[model samples]
Target: MMFFCCSFMGAVAQADCLNTENLLKLDAQYETALQVGSVQFLDKLLAPEFYWVHNLASLQETKAQLLMRIKKPEAQAHQRRSHDVSAHRLGNTVVLQGLSSVDKLNPDGKTLRTSRYQFMRTYVEQQGECKLLAVQTMKVWSSEGN
Candidate 1:
């Protein structure tokens, strides 16, 4: 019975696309949440112990602060696009690295001070769920192309 159960579990694991498809869906949801300023979804997507470092060398922010910013009107004025995103999985932990281009609008969706950036984010599984744990972002020099 134990061997059968193990085999059944292995088959289920093989059938589950949690590592690939689910991760991609989570990534898309994250971006969409940011764009629409959905604080609830953002809160659920990030881990309780999450931390983020901005490109301007600012202090890290906690999950609550991040969610609060997303709910703010000012956050709606900033637009961010992430490109060249790549993900690597080690067991249940995933690391996503990407290049980003940002445009802070002047309350009119007009691009202001376009900048390029490099970002690294870590995601881990907790309580049978995947959540973003940490992020680090650095500004790219002018020569790096915005």
Candidate 2:
């Protein structure tokens, strides 16, 4: 009985890691979408009730609003890269926490702004697909001393 229980627990642990890994890959695709302002990619990845809290404005945007912004002609391209990403699986939900650096480019393709941020995103599985539910980001003011 003891051996059976140990094996079952080990299997559960391995399953959790596998789930986390899958979510991490999805999160990477999300980062790419953000950088390129891919509305189509975002539409597929975001839940209908998705919400995002921006780091600079402290503003919250719904899925529709976010898609609208992405379609704007003046919208800048964002080059974002995530680092030290960690995903935690909670049943059908996964939470991703990471640090990211972003470079914002103007419509003319000139670099306009750059910043580092810490972000947390939650993804929920629905209909055999994972979608982003909510995300919140905070700017990292100074990495110099760290």
Model 1 / residue 48 / CA error / Å = 0.5
**By TM-score, how accurate is candidate 1?**
0.74
Pairs of residues at least 3 apart in sequence or in different chains that clash in candidate 2: none
Worst 10 residues of 2 by lDDT: 1-10
lDDT of 1: 0.69
lDDT for position 139 in model 1? 86
TM-score of each: 0.74, 0.75
* Residue-wise C-alpha lDDT for candidate 1, range 70-134, written one tens digit per residue: 78767752556778888898887888888876566544555465667798888887656677899
lDDT values for all models: 0.69, 0.71
Model 1 ranges with Cα > 4 A deviation? 1-18, 107-111, 141-146
Residue 6 lDDT in model 2?
32
* RMSD in order of candidates: 9.0, 10.3
lDDT of 2 at 77: 45
Error of 1 at 56 (Å): 4.4
